[model samples]
Target chain A: MPTTLRDEAAIAGIGQTPYSKNSGVSELALACQAVRGAIADAGIEPREVDGLVTFLMDSSDEVEVARSVGLGDLSLLSRVAYGGGAAVPIVQQAAMAVATGVCRHVVVYRALNGRSGQRMGQGVSGDIITSDLIHWSWYMPFGMLTPASWVAMAATRYMHEYGDCADALAQVAVVTRNHAQNNPAAAFYGKPLSLEEYYNSRWICEPLRLFDCCQETDGGCALLITSPERARDLQQRPAVIRGVSQASFDGQEQMTSFYRPDMHRLPEMERAGETAYAQSGLGPADMDAAILYDAFTPEVLMQLEAFGFCGPGEGADFVRDGALAAGGRLPTNTHGGLLSEAYIHGVNGVAEAVRLIRGVSHNQPERCEHVLVSSGVGVPTGALILGRDNG
Target chain B: MLTPEQKQDLETQIRAFVGRPTGPPSVGRDLVNEPMIRQWCDAIGDANPVYLDPEAAARSVHGGIVAPPMMLQAWILEGWSMHRGHGEPRDEQQRLHKILTDAGYTGVLGTDTEQTFTRYLRPGDQVSAETVIADISEEKATGVGVGYFITTRTTFCDAKGIELGTMNFRVLKFIPKEAPQSAAANADAADAQPQKPTRIKPPLSHDNAWWWRAVAEGTLLPLQRCAQCQKLRHPPRPMCDDCGATQWDHIAASGRGALHSYTVIHHPRFPGYEFPILAALVDLPEGCRIVSNVVDCEPGALRIGMALQAFIHEDEDGFKLPLFRPAEPA
Candidate 1:
C-alpha cells in the first residue's frame, strides 16, 4: 500500500521465446521455456527462485510449471484472472512477495498459444453459465451472445455521446501497426494499413473492424523480479515496479455493460490509475514510454484517457501527432503488442515495457526514464509503472 | 395412447397450474442486495459490467444485470444440504422435490430451453420473479404409482413484477407404497443409454446460451443442469441430477406443451424473434417438461405464461421454432 513498495522493487531480468502463429510444444513447455530464459537472462540459478506467478487463463499448474522449469522450491506461487488484466499485476505479486520477505527471487511467466492454440476471441457458444447464462438466458435469449457483439453496443453508444465518428477508433490500429511494421517479432510486421483501411474494414459487430481486434498469437514471455538491492546485481538493467494497482468498478458486467450511465468513463481503469499513481508517487507526465495493451485498438485510446495522458476523447488527438514511435513523446507497443505481437494475453506487453526501460527493445524509444504497462481493459483492469532501479 | 390433441390438453393444464397466482409475492429483491447478488454471481461467473459496474449499469437502459435464468438450479442442491440426503444419502427424487417446494420454490420441467441476448444484465439492477399457482390436475399413473399427480405453475416478474416467463412442472404423488418396482433397474438402464445432453457443450458448461439448434418433432433434448448446483440446471450431472437423483433419467418427453407463458418481442436481440415475433414458455405434460418460444396466437391474448400447444418449428435459417397455441382452460 505504501509508495515505497513501487520504487523499491524492480525487474531483475526479462526474456521472451520466439513469437509464433502456432507451436509444437504444449502450453506448459512454452511456460517452462520462458521461465528458464528469464532466469538465465537474470543470471540467476533456478534454485534461487523462491516464488512464481502466472495468468489464471493458462492451463499449466504452478507446481507443474516449477517442476518443468527445474525450480527446486518456492515459498509463494500465485495467479491473477480477469483475462489480460493479469499483465502487470503478476509482476506486482512477485514484487510484493519479495518485498514482504515471503520469497526472495520470483519468476513470472505467461505462455499463450493464444492465436492458433486457444483462440479465446473466436467467440463462445453452447456453454451454460449457471449464473451468467442462467442470468443470460434472461437477457441473451432476448439477443446478447458474442463478446464483441456485446461490447460493440457500448462502443456505438460511446461514439454517440462523444460526437466522434468511428474514425476515432481508426487512429489506434494504424498507430500501433505503424510501430509493429518495423518490429520483426510482430505477427503484423510489414502489415500496415491506412486509416481509411481501418474505417472500410468489415464490422464484427458494429464499429469494430478486422484490424481493430488483437492478433491471436502463440507465444510466451517471462520476467525475473527481486528487491532493488538484489536487482542491481543481476545481469540486465532492472526495470523497477514503480507502481501497480488493480480495480473493478460498480455495475461492471463481464462484457455487456449496457446499463452504464457514461460510456466515456472506464471507472475500473481510472481507479487502477489512481491507485498506481498514489502508490508510485509518480504522475502521467513523468512516464518516459509505455507498452499499453492493444487487445482492441480502441481500448488503448480509452486507456490513454484513463491513465491521464490525455483527457476524455483527446486520446485520439494525443497520439495523432505520431509521437508514439521512436524519438517521439512516449513510444508505445514498441514490441508490436497483441495486435502485431503474438497475443500472450497481456504478458507480452509487460515484456515490451521492460525492453523499453532497458533500451533493448527492437523499436527502442529515444528517452527512457519510466515505462508504463497495463492489463486488460473493460472488465477488471490492472496497471504498473516500471523504472530503472536507482539503488 | 395420447392423441396429439390429448397431449395438447394435458400440456395446457400444466401451464395453468404454474402460471396462475394466489396472492402477492412472499419475497421480492432489487439490485441493491449485493451480498445476495455477490453470492449468486460467484456461484455462476458473471464478471461482466452489466452486473458489476455502477456507472456502466446506470448507463445501461435496462439498469443492471438481471440474474441468470439457471440460477434457480442452486435450490436443488441446497435443498439436499438442508436434508442431508434421503435419510441415508440415497438419491431420492420424491424427497428432493418436496424439500425444494417446501422452501417456497417450484421449477418447470425444462425439456428444452433457449436464450438469445439483445441486452446483458448489470449489477445493482432490480430483478424479481413471482411464483404463482397456475392450474392443477389428477392422473392415474401405471409406471410406479396409482394415485393423484399435481402440476404447479409459476412465472418470473420484474421489479414491477412484469411477467418474464412462465414455469410449469408436474409433481407425481403416489399411494405411498406403489413405488416403481425397478428403481435401481431404471437407474442402471438410464446409465446404459447415457444420452448426451442437448443443452451443454465442452469446456465452458455453465455459460451455455446458444448451444443447440432448434429440435425436430420426435427429437429429444436431454434436460441439462450444472454439476455443482442442482435445481433446474442445464449442464447436467448426477451430483446435480437436476431433480436431485444420483440416477440420471433420459425421459422421452411427449414434447408437446401448451403455451403456459408467451411474449412478442418488439426487437431482435431476443434471438429467434425479429420484427415483433412471438415467444413464450410451454408446458409438456408427459415428461412434465416446459420450454419457451413464439406460438400461433394473437400477441394480445398470449397472457402470463399461458397454456398454448407446442410443436417443433425451425426457421429456414436453421433455427427450430418452439411454436405454441392456447389450450382450453383446465
Candidate 2:
C-alpha cells in the first residue's frame, strides 16, 4: 500500500510583489523579486534551494529563475499545466520533492504581468496554434470569447438550479473586499465593496456583475518548501502541509466544460477536496478558514459546496449574515482573494493559506488551525490542507 | 451609375417590400428519414449512438432517431431537379433581385443566418416554411463590393400546424468593386479606407478538419464514434476515450435540444459580433451538448429547459457555422 504524504513537508515562507494592474517591471524581474523575498523569509542562503516548480503557463524559465535568484543546482525542476489550476499542484510538486529527499529545499513560484501584458480577460487571439485551439473553435465564432463568458455559461445554469443566487455571489465579493480593507498588500485595500455596490455594478456577462470578476492583476507570489524536520530549524514557524492533491476528472475540457450532466458543479474540486481530506485525516469541520479560488464569485459558491463546507445548493445560505467575515465560523479569503487581492493565477491564495496557518495574516481569524486553499474552479483543479505546526 | 434620385427611387421600391411575404409557404417534398440523418452524421462525423442506434435511442433522452437541428433549412431546400430556370422572376424575392440587377447591383452573396427550432424532428415528420422580407441596410462599402444588405425571416412549421422554428437570413446585393470600369477610377479609393475586421476563424487541424469541412458544407453536424465501444464524442479527436480504439466513425446529430445553461456577454465585445451575444450550452436529444449562439430571442425569454434547434449560418465571407434559436409555439 502507498503511504500518505501528509505532514511530510512544510511551507517555510511565503512572499510576493505588490498586486498591481501594471507592474512596470518585467515578469522575470517580478519572479526573481518574489523568490528572493521567499528565500530571505525562509532565513536560508540562496544556494540552499535545490528545486524549482511553477506553472507551464509561466513565462519565467526554471534555469533563468534559478540564475536570477541564485538558486543552486536544481534536482527537481518542474511545471504544472492548467494555468489558474496549477497553484496547489506547484506546491505539491515541491513538497513531494522535499519529502522524497530528491531536493532539500524547493521553491515554487508564479509570475505574470497579467493585466499590463497578455491579459487573460481578452478573447482568444487568432494567431496561436495550440491544443486548446480546437475546442475554442466551437464557441469562439459565436462570441464566447473571454474567461467571464466561459464561466458564465455554467454560472447561468447554477442560478437556474439554485434560483438566482446573485445576493450570495455578491456576499463573496463584499466579504473578500471587506477583508482587503486592512491588508495594504491587497489592490482593493482602501476600496471596500458594499452589497449594494456589488448589485449596482455593470454586468460583464449576465448573472456575473463586474465586481463578480477577479482583478486582472500584475504581480508574482512564491513559497519555499522543505521537510517538517528541516522547517523546524527555520526562522519562522512552518505551516505544515497536512495534505495536498491535484484532480482532473474524466471528460474535462480546459475551461469551457459545459457539457457535463451537471454544468453547475465542480467535480474536479470535489475529487481534490476528498483526496486532500482523506490524506490529512480531516474533514470540512476541521478547517478553521479557507481560501477558495475567487477568480469569479460564482466559483467561490460552487467551491463552498464541493469542499463540503455547505450542502449542495446551500452555499448561498452558508455565506449569509457575514459568515465569511473575520469572526465567522469559517473566515475565507481573509486576504481579499483574487477578487480584491492579486491574481497571481492563485499562487497568492496559497501564500495567504500559509499566512493563516502561521497566525500572521492581516485578516487573521481567531481560531485558525487548518486552512483549506483551493485553485481555480471550472477546470482541472487542486486543493491543499495546511495546518499550524503542533511541535 | 444611378443618380441620387434613381438610388433613392430604388431604395423606396425595395423598402416597400419590407414586412411583406416574400413567397407562399413551401412544403418539403419528403418526410424526415434516417438516411439523411445518417448522411449528415457521416459528412459531419457525429456518432452519438442515440442518433444512429434505435436500441440506444430507446434508452436515450430523445427516445428515437431524429434529424439534426442544423438540417432545419435543409428539409425545406428546393432540390436541384426543381430549379426554376433563368426565366421570369418567380416571387417577391426574385422580383427584388431582378430590380437590384437592373439597377447595376449585379453581385449577390449570402451573408449570415440565424435559425431557431422549437423541437427535434423524428422520422416521418414533414416540414413547411414561410418567408418574409425582414430588413434592408443602407448602401455601404464592403471588401468585395459596394452593396445593400437584405435580410429575410422564415418561419418553419410541422404538418400538424404547430410552429416549429424560424430563421433570419441576410444577403448582400452589390456591384463588384473590381469591375473594369470601377478599377481604374477607384483604385486608390478602396486602398485609402481602413479594412474592416473579419470574424475570428476557427483553427483547423488534422484531427478536426473534417468536422469544420462538414459544417462549411451546411448540411450536417457530425459526432465521432468509437468503432469498438461505440461511444460518441464531439469537437472531434483521433482516439476514443472509452475503448481507446484508434478506429472510429461518425453520425449526424439531431440538433434538437433543450437549453442547459447560457451566458449573455456584455463586456469586452469582440469585433464583427453583436453585443449581448446569447451563448448557450444546449443538450441535444442524442445525448450530447454543444456550445452555440442562441439567436433571435431576448435574453429575458431564455429558460434552462427551453427547446431549441440548430441551423447553419453562412456569413458574408462564406464562413459557415452552426447557431441556434428558440422553438416558438404556433
Candidate 3:
C-alpha cells in the first residue's frame, strides 16, 4: 500500500501546563497558555497560526482560543469526539490540513479542569439528556455507571479468556509509577508504587484496583503542526508526523461495546495501528519507544496487543518480561502515563512522544528515533507515528 | 473477640437457624395484572412496546405480554407492614433479628442481593416466595461498625408451585459506636431536614421509552426488531441501521444467555446500590447483548461464557430492574 501522508507534515513544537489535581484557573486560560507555549516553542508568531483543532468535549472553542492567543483568520477548524480517543486524530487532522495546504500552520490542543471541576469518574449526571445517555440507560439501571466499570467488563473477560490475573494489570501500575518517580511533573513523582501495594489497593472495580485507574487531573496540552519544509527553519528538531490514522469497527459503542464479537481485542485500535504503520511504512519493530494511552492500565496492555507490540493474549507476558521499562524492547509511557502522570487525556502522551523524538525526554531512552503514540482504547481511536528528522 | 465457649455457643446458635425456613410460603395479594405492570413501567421508565402494546405483543416472538422478570421479589414482598415488625414474630427472620437485637446489635443495613429467574411471570400468574437462612458470618469490622452479614435465600414460585426464581439477599446487622450527644443531635437535625435525593434514575428519552415500558410490563430483554431487514438491535434506536428503516417493532428476548463479560464495582458508591456489585454483559441467544447486574454468584465464580438466566431485581425504593444469574446445571 502506498503511504498517503507520510513525512508530509511535522510536529514543530509541543507544550503543556503543569498537570495537577487543581490548576486553579479557567479551562480557557489553560487552553491559551498551552497554545501560546506551543507557538513560542515553534518559533512562530501567534498570528501565523491558520488552523486549530480540539476535542468536541473541550470547553474552549476555536474562535475563543484564537482570540485568546491572538491568532489571525483560520482556514481549518475541526473537533474530534469520543473523549481521549480524539487525541491523536486532532493531530492527524492538523497534519492532513497542513499537508494538503488547507492551512499553513496548525495547533492542536486539549484543556480541562477534570479533577477540581467535572470529574469524569463521577459518571453521568441526570440533567444532560442525549442519545448516548439513552443507550447508557440499558446498563445504568444495573449500576454499571462509571468508565472504570465500563472498561472493567472487557478487562475481566480478557483475564478470564487468557488465564491472566490482576497481577498482569498491576504490573502496568508498578512500571508506570516507577517511571513517574524520576519525573517531577508526574502526580506520583514522590510516591513509588509496589506490586504488593497494588494488590493491597482497594478495588475501584474488580480486575481493576485503585492503582489501575488514571488520576483525575486538571491540565492542558498542545502541539504545533506545520509542513516539513517549514519545520526545518524552526528553532527545534521536528518530530515528523510519518503517519496518522483514525478508525472504528462495526458494532462499536462508546465504552460499553459489549455486543462486539470479540470482547478482549480492540479492533478499532488494531485498524488505526495498521493504517498508521502502512502509511508510515514503519512497523512496530521500527519504534524505539511507545507512548500508549494509559487511561486505564488494562487498555495499555490491550493496545500493546492491538498495535502488534506483542502477539494476541501475550500482553501480560510482554510486560512481565520488563519490555515496557527503560532498557526493555519497547519503553512505554516513560513519563509515567496517565496512571502516574496527571491525566490530560492522551495529548500529554503526544507531547511525550515529541519529547522522545526531540531527544529531550526526562527519562530519555538510549536511542530515541521513532515513537508510537496511541489515543484512547475501547472507543473509535487513532494512532500516530512520529520520527526524528535526521536530515 | 469471643471467648472459646462464647464462640462455640454463637456458632451453634447461628448454625441451628441455617436451612430452616425464614417464613411460611406466602402468595402475593394480587395476581400479576396490567395496571400494576403499567405502574411499574411508568416508575422505571421502560417503554418497550411488547409490554404495553397488545398489537405489538401479538407480532413478537413471545406472542403476548409478559411481566419483567425482576419483579419476582416485588410480587411477594409481604408489604411494609410485615417488614416493620408490626405483628407477632412468627418467622425465622424476626427470630433472627430478635436474637441479634437482644445481643446488642440493633442497627440494620442491607449489604447485597442476588437473584436468578427461571421464566417470565405473566399477567394473572399468582406468585409466592419462601425464605430460608443461607449463612451467618462471624463478626467482622466494617466502615459502618462491627457487624454480622446475614444472608437469606428466597425461592419464588407460581400457584402451581413451579419455581419461578430465587433471590439471595444479605444485610449487615451492627452495633453502632457511641456518639457524642452534640454529634448525635447534629445528625438528628441533619436527618430531620429533608435530605437531597442522591439516587439518579435512568434518563428516559423518546427513542428508548418503549424499551422501558416493556421493562415495566415485566418483559425481559426487549430488543428492537427492524421491520425492513429483520435485524435485532439493542440500546434501542429511532431507525434501523441495517435497512435504514424508520419503522420497527420489538421482541421479548429469551432470558437465556451467557456471561460475555462482567465486572465487580466497588467504588464511588451510588445510592440504592450495594458495593462490589457484579455487573455483567450477557449475550442473549438472539445474538444481541445487554448489560445487567449478575447476582446469586460469588464475584470470583463469574467466568466468561457461563450460562445465565434473567431475574427481576427490585430495589429498596420498589423500582424493578432486569438482572442475571448463573444457570444451574441441567
Candidate 4:
C-alpha cells in the first residue's frame, strides 16, 4: 500500500571522526569534520547542499554547519528528537528532498562528548528542581534517579515472563563485542566479552548488569543522501535507501514507564516496525543483515519479537538458535554496537547497515543487501532499509 | 534544637530525597505543604498575587490558593512522629517526617506528575492534602549498599482531598533479612584533578552579570534567570530543559540555596587541573534546577543539599564564578 522510503533515495556518502573519550574538540568542530567528510565522500561540493537533519540534543546549528562545510543557501532543513534515531532518517530526509526537487544534497551529523562532556548518569541534578520533575521528584526523593534503574524495571518484568532473559540479553552484548573485536573503529574494538563476564559485570540497576547498558562515548558520525544518479557521480558507492519510518507509542513517558500495563511489550516499536516493514515490502525473511539499536540487551530480544523475527515469547529461543549472529539467520550490530562499539547514538548503527549493504563492513557477510537499521528501544524510535541499487 | 540522634535522622532522611533508595521503610513526602509551595513560588520568582495575597483568594476559580503543579510539596507520613530520634532538635520538622512514615501508608510514595498552569500561585488558601498510592514494586536499590525497597506512585489532591495530580515516589522497606548499610563512608579516593578550564570569555551573560555576581563566585558564570520555566534554572536552557515545557519566566535568583549532592573528582571530565575541588549540586532556595560543582569545600564534607548562600569564586581566568556556601537556613 505504501512505497518504501528506500526506492525513493540513496545514501551517497558517509563520514566520521574516530570515537573517543577526550576528543578535545568542540561540538562544532566535530560536526564540521563529519559534514565535510560526508560531502567529500559523496563527491558533492558543499555548496550544492540544501538540507540537514541532526539530533535535538546536538549543539551545532544548521547555519553553523552550513558555513563550516561551506554550503550555500539551504532550502530544506530539520531536527529530529529522541537521540540516535536520526541516523538513517537523515538519508531519508535527503532522499525526500531529491524526490521533491527541493534540495539536492542533505547531510546529517551528531558530535558530542557524551561521556567526557555531558554525563547522563551524573544523577538528577537539573531536572529535579522543576515541577515537571515532580513525578520523578517522588522517585528522586527515594533515589531512583538514573535511566538504567528505570530500564531495569522493564527488564525485571521480561525476566519474569521468560526464566532466562539474562542469557538472551547477554547474547546481544557478546555478539556486539564479537564484532567490535574485529572492527578497529569501535571504542571496544579488540576487547572481547563472555557471558560470564556479562552477568558478572557491576550492577547499575537491578536486573541490568553494567554490560547490559549502553556506554557513553565521545564521537561524531555523519551521512550524505541524494538521488541515485547524483550518487553515481559521487566519490563513493551509494547505498540505496530502501524504506524508512519512525514511531512513538501510547503509554510512552521518557525512559521511565514503570506503571505500564505490561513492561515486556514494547508497542511503540511494533507500531514503527509494522509501518516500516510494509513500506520496505521486506519482512524478516528478506533482511540479510540487521543493525538494530542495542542500547540495552533486553531491548534486542524485545525488538526481535516486535519485528516478527520470532513470535512473542519466542525471541529468547530465536536468539539462542543463533538466528541473530554473524553466521546465523540475521547478522546484527556487526559494527559492534552501542553496547560494544562506541555509542555515537543510534546513528553508528545506520553507518554499519549502509556498510553492510555496500559490502564493506569489517564483519561483512556473504551476499548481504537488505540491511535493517533501527533507533533506540523503548523511546520513540525509527528504522530504515538500505539495499544495493539492484535496479 | 533537637537531640543529636534527631539531627542525624533528619540528615539521613533528607539524604534519601531524590535518587532511588536500595533498602526499606525510608520516608519521603506525599504532597505539597503550604511552606514548600511558598518557597517554590518565591524561588521561581513568580510575583503573581495568587501566591502572595491570601485575601485576594477565596474569589478564584479552583477556590483556594491552589499551588502551580510545579510547586515542591514537603512530604510527610502519618504516625512517623513517634520515631525515637525525635529526642533531637528541629522538633516540628522531625515530627512531620515521622507522621508521614507511620500513617496507614505503607511504602506510600510519589508517582509521576504533570503540570499545566491554569493560573499563577498566590499565598494562603484553605490548604490541605490528599494522597493515594499505587504501583507497588519490590526491588533492590542502586548506589550505596544493597537492600530491597518498595516504590509506589502517589497522587496529591486539595483539601476536600480532591485529586489535583500525581507523583510516583519509591520507598525501600528492608525485608527482614536485608539490612542496608547505616552510614556510608565518603568516597575515599582523593579527587584526581579538574580539567583545564575552558577559557570562556569574561561576562558570559547575555543578560545582567552584575546582579548574579552579587550572589556568587568568579568563573562560576553569572546565574542568569531564565525567562522560561518561571524559576531560577541554570546552565541556561533555551527551553525548560527538564520537561521541554516552554512557558518561561526569567527571574534573578535570590542567591540562596542548599547543597543537594556533592562529589570531589579524582579526574576532570575535561582535561588538566591539579587538585580536586568540591563539586556540589546546589538546591537553590529559588525553585527549579540544582547546578553542578559550585567549587570550594573539602570534597567529603559537602552534605546533601546543604543550606547555601551564593558567592563568587575566581578561577585562573579573569571571569567570575557563581558558587554557593552553607547559607543560614530559611
Evaluate residue A21 in candidate 3 and report its C-alpha lDDT on the 0 to 100 scale. Answer: 84
Give the per-residue lDDT of model 4 (tens digit) for B125-237: 23233333332333343332222233334444444544544545444422212122232111111111212333222232323334344434322334445453444445444
TM-score of each: 0.56, 0.74, 0.73, 0.55
Question: DockQ of candidate 4?
Answer: 0.02
What ordering of candidates by DockQ runs from best to worst?
2, 3, 1, 4
lDDT of 3 by residue, A1-391 (tens): 2238899899998889988888999999999999999999999999999999999999999999999899999999899999999999999999889888899999999999999998988886565789888877777777878999998888988887787756778888899999899889898999999888889988998878899999899999999999888999999899999899999998888987887778899999999999999998899999999999998889988989999999999999999898999889999999999899878889999998998998888789999889999998888999999998965
Query: Candidate 2 lDDT, tens digit per residue, B1-330?
Result: 899999899999999989989889999888898988898889989998767889988887898887788888888988884444434677898788778867867667777899888999999999999999989898998866788899999999999989889999998878765453444223222122323445777787877778878788765577788889988887678898777898987888887878888888999867678888898888887787888888989999898899998888888778888888887664
Docking class of 2: medium
- Model 1 Cα interface RMS deviation (Å): 10.6
Give native contacts recovered, as a fraction, per prediction: 0.05, 0.84, 0.84, 0.00
Estimate, for each residue in A327-389, the C-alpha lDDT of model 4 and write its tens digit: 888888898988888788887788788788778999899979788788877677777877888
Q: How much is the lDDT of residue A290 in candidate 3?
A: 95
> What DockQ does each candidate score versus the true complex, computed on alpha carbons?
0.03, 0.52, 0.48, 0.02
Question: What's the true lDDT of residue A295 in model 1?
Answer: 76
Each prediction's interface RMSD?
Answer: 10.6, 1.1, 1.3, 12.6
Score candidate 3 by lDDT.
0.86
Question: What shift in Å separates residue A70 of candidate 1 from its native position after superposition?
Answer: 0.6
Best by TM-score: 2
Better of 2 and 4 by TM-score: 2
The C-alpha RMSD of each candidate to the native structure, in angstroms, is 26.5, 19.7, 19.8, 26.0
Tens-digit lDDT string for candidate 1 (A265-314): 68888888888898888999999887787777667777888889888877
Off by over 4 Å in 4: A1-6, A127-135, B1-330
